[model samples]
Target: MKRVLIPVAFLFALFAGSGSAAAAPPIPVEPTTETLDCPGFQVDAVYTGKAKWIDAPVASGTKKRLKLFTGVAAASTATLTGPAPTSKVISLSLNGSISWSIVLSPEFDIVITGTGRNLISDPQHGDYPGGLFLTVGKVSWSLNAPDYPNGGITGPGSVTDVCALLAP
Candidate 1:
């Protein structure tokens, strides 16, 4: 019994010394920079185009939109960096005038669902969710105005007008 117990203890020690049992070092990630092509539409184009008025004239300004591209490159270099999770809806309105353009760049709550992709144009509302579908690629998303809930169509103070100006 003594001999068997000693051998068991020695075997346990031997297994414990195996490097494989040790935790592996955390993988180091390098910081990377990537540009999401706006496709000249989205927010950037909306600001560029619009009609001017007096009382609440639409201001004129340059707007730009960017979507992150995916794959190994699309993956964010910062392992744990991104917008804080939120559920509130974001609103974007550009009041354009001949001389002035109102530009609002709000950080939207977007979810990444379905196939993994870099950029995806949300079909429903501008409040997009999902990681972005790779197959669908980059598409145009509609921004429904809060002040004026005009269904899916664009109306006064709507993203539709801005998209029209951005039309490529």
Candidate 2:
């Protein structure tokens, strides 16, 4: 349930082009390691993958849309630091493909389809649950602002609490 998306999103921003530039073509992501920010501690995530740009942002429209396919193999390990401290090797692994559609209209919106991990850390909406979830099938989330990690999630699908595997 740890981010395959987090790594992918990083690559996305690198390959992503803004207005006046169409989506970049398929780019292979070199194997790399990145630090992941979790609720309590941090994890070192290593991954290799590729993203194929399917749709460029609409050239002219109030709504900007982008589509793409991504597949990655990601794994992570870390020690819980804030609470529930453990010496056990906190680890997670994921290999999967996903389709993502991002839009900007009234707000920056996203819809991801396929199987992967999603972190929901938004905690300001009246009795909302916050955690990292291994979401299978499909899940949708919206950020309060672009490039923000915390956001609210709402969708129907199989959800697994990843902390159980990583720490508990």
User: Which candidate number has the best TM-score?
Assistant: 2
Model 1: lDDT of residue 29: 32
Error of 2 at 107 (Å): 4.7
- Stretches off by above 4 angstroms in model 2 are 1-28, 49-131, 145-151
Q: TM-score of predicted model 2? A: 0.49
Worst 10-residue lDDT window for candidate 2 reads: 73-82
Across residues 1-168, which tens digit of lDDT does each residue of candidate 1 receive? Answer: 000001111111222222221123222133222211222322211111112112222334554433321111111111111222421222232121111112245643221111211122222223321121122222222332231221222212212222222234
Best by lDDT: 2
| Displacement of the residue 27 alpha carbon in candidate 2, Å | 7.4
TM-score of each model, paired residue for residue: 0.16, 0.49
**Prediction 1 global C-alpha lDDT:** 0.21
